[model samples]
Target: MIPELCDQRIRQFINGSDFVLAMNEDNHVFSWGDNHCGQCGRKATPFRVYLKPEVISDLNDKNITHICCGFKHSLALTTDGQVYGWGSYYEQYQNAEGSDTRVINSCENHYKSFFEELSDNPIGSGGFGTVFKVRHRFDEHIYAVKRIHKEDEIKNHMEVKNLVKVRSKYVVQYYNSWTEGIILYIQMELCEYNLQNILEVKLQVFGRQLGEAMDSVEYLISCEIFRQVLESVQYLHELNPQIIHRDLKPENILITLGKAMDCVEYLISCEIFRQILESVQYLHEMNPQIIHRDLKPENILIAENIRNGRFVKLCDFGLATVHDKRVHYRTTQKHTADVGDMRYIAPEVSQGGKYGHKCDIYSLALIGGNIFEIDLFNLELEDTNVYSELYQILNEPVYRLQTILISMFRTRLWHRRPECSEVLSEYNEWSIDRNILANDTRFDGILSILQSNDNHLFIELSAIGSGGFGTVFKVKHRFEEHIYAIKRVEIKDESEEYLQRFYNEVKNLIKVRSEYCVQYYNSWTEGNILYIHMELCEHNLQNILEVKQQVFDRKLGKAMDCVEYLISCEIFRQILESVQYLHEMNPQIIHRDLKPEN
Candidate 1:
């Protein structure tokens, strides 16, 4: 009875026009439901109640391994890692004849012959269509072949054309495509796995629990991973043609294992972020804007592991679109089916309104929130229900944290959230502050001392110099027998900007430890005066120059040589390297007051 039922179901599947199936072990084809573009792969009958399974000639004898179906397109994979596709071809071509041998050709051919050779076989399938793994006949190298049903040939062609122009570490590379009978086949690089697989592994390792036993190190590593992913998305959104990976989900993201923890760390190092930013910036400057309508994890691919299992490559551009105001494609009237996944779709997208890169920002925040299991949109206010839960998890003051979280998850499209550039800046600031507080005990202790001292300590130092914002004095530490430079600043009591700048300067200088730049030893506030202690150098470059003009003596030349020698020293080399590092920073900051003296 079971065998009979199974056979009946198989027959029904084969006879149904809406159902389309491809078998790996045997190239068996089944169809049911809809068959608008002959998707059933069956010949049209004069009068029939249902369509019967028709064996595809091109796929016969091929050891099929996988099958993918787009809305109307179909793709098949073979054991030899070759991809074969069948579907509609909306692209038009012109056939012209040369009257004479010497006649010049005016019209160039835009289309290539279809299914002339089989290089790779299909391995995976997706919403837009199916993918195959093909091997080069001569070198036997493997590749991923993608076939879009003719129903989606135009959009697929545009995606392929756009992807070909942009070069990014997060994007998949497009190869070539052609038409065979009724199908269109596009071959591309064969990637390993998607991001979904990696997250699943992580979830399993953690016992499939959302927020259990997750440590600081794990969170830190995850934060770094999120940073890299955003950098890639930002790069795509910034492209000239401005390609957006509208569908960016974990399944589309790929990951590989590495040998050591540091390997992954190096893969997601600051240097890599710079590279990603530059690429995104280049994309943003393109002529036509590209918006990735779907920015979910499934659309991201993890091609390989960089640095021995430390970093991953992002892939999948099936739902990517160009955001061009001047060149608008009638998507509403034409292909009206829902475009994005339900989980990561932006609010604006869900409401059927137009969106730009900010939509990507919302999706990115969602991705971050999911990984951290922290809601970035709704702030945990004292009056809100989630406040107690948030307090328990963070174990710190929730007001400021709530403010930051609320600012991140604003609902209005334009006013709702900060730009990618801004988010990166905030992350950098927070990261630097955290590093300073964690690493510098003296500075941390100074904050405590300032809180207790109030108006106790008095400055008893000689004023040595003054600058635009503050004054520097050489003084003795009241309690310790140490001489230090105290920089005092006077600002309006209510000026948070001034206070922030002062603290930022201290933090920036302290975080920076290079021989070329003066280092921050300590900083404190007493009464109304803010004091910053820094390493004291004997002479400024301007003073040295003045001294040189006074006398060109042997001693002066030796002094200049000594200064030059110090600059040439390995320690000074490190200083120059540090300065270069600062210059290469994101947002490209410049030290405007780079003269010899502050």
Candidate 2:
């Protein structure tokens, strides 16, 4: 038994003039021995011998059912009734149809019979190849035909092979591929435009300005487009042999348009940063991680989806790299430095050091900053001075986003940076805090818990107040029927420092024993949220003052009534006494949240 065929379990063997073809139990084909005239389906010259069997990887998924060999030639038959032949039997394959064999030949005459070029001028041209508009003779449907000049005789080009392996709604669809003369032709789904065109149109509308930020509507559309792109990347990263789109720029991504909808509204706010991080998270989580070393805005494409409106298609995998499994962390070593655009490449990559999937996260942060028009100066600098310009122009939301971006741009301290999954989680919470998903149906399950349930002790009456820390709800005990206030604070950060602050607040509440102070009855933790039950007050200081103003209007202040003045003095005295009581504690507890609403 041949050692190479031992693992695969050889099912059948056929002999050529000086070579041998073996069919495995899995329907895979392997060839070896004399490879003269390419009978072995491998690159070889006359009399060249392959002592060990080499897999014909091109036909791995063909489900080859039978193999036949002729003098200096070979052929394989697949279960789907298709025939594939290579080597010296060129002329005989012309009449292969007569024998009921559908040959996957790509000769000049065969290509002309199947596809017809529509125009003399090429539709698009890039580093990979030149694209032309072509129509299938039988189906009469137009397709984008990419004609790549044969530079390498490696059977399959990287882009074509990657495209054939990927099947995603957000990726450009591959139809067919063939070789004609010295050119490789690939048929793909046609798109009207690319993301660059959209950006150009937006720039034109803004009078060719560069730094102008997109309005909320345009930003939302951009977010939707990026959401699909992230999903496509996630799909690639989840593949058995993970794929990385080494060249992730705008030009590679194509756009398709759909019918215009009337008065459409977006209920869920799209967090492009979060979506991007989620995609990268998948890549980093793989056993042998994949890294998209080249990631920029140019690689992102906008496409139309029938069910979801405008979406993004992530294209171009020419530079994607999978990690070497030999490494402990599955990181790639000796990667080509200065491979991607200077603006988006990570410091570790540009500096020619060992890097992992975190490099992609760095690129993602740069792209996120670009989408929001956040300027990142000297991104390689390990200081907040890189964000000095951002502080001057950005508002609160942008400020928070840039802070996250800065964490990703950790320069040489990349290990200290948060993982893509952590970044995504932070952004998810950010979206919720912004009330973007206030009406989102997905949150209905959590909101439903506010009603009387077996897990909860009280039934919520109403939302009394809400602030950055938590939301206070008026609730009645299910068994006791006593009204009380319950403050529910989501536990976003589980760090000891954050939890210590929360515990300290609870401690202070337990220690205080004053009639003026809100009495804390009990506290508990459930599902990443802290719940505190306290004595319910009829009105807060602000509510009482507002009601008093409405009752007297302008008359009370100007007329200076004695009864109203005395009531206001008593309220002020109580507030001062509460503050005094807290300060007089052994370890004085300062009420930081002392606003009127509190």
Best by lDDT: 2
TM-score to native of every candidate shown: 0.26, 0.34
The 10-residue segment of model 2 with minimum total lDDT is: 259-268
lDDT (Cα, tens digit) per residue for candidate 1, span 374-437: 4442223464433222113222323333344455454554345665565455444322233423
lDDT of 2 at 218: 42
Quantify all predictions' global Cα lDDT against the true fold: 0.51, 0.68
Question: What RMSD, rounded to one decimal, does every model reach?
Answer: 28.9, 27.6
TM-score of 2: 0.34
Cα distance off (Å), candidate 2, residue 402: 40
Candidate 2 Cα deviation (angstroms), residue 386? 50
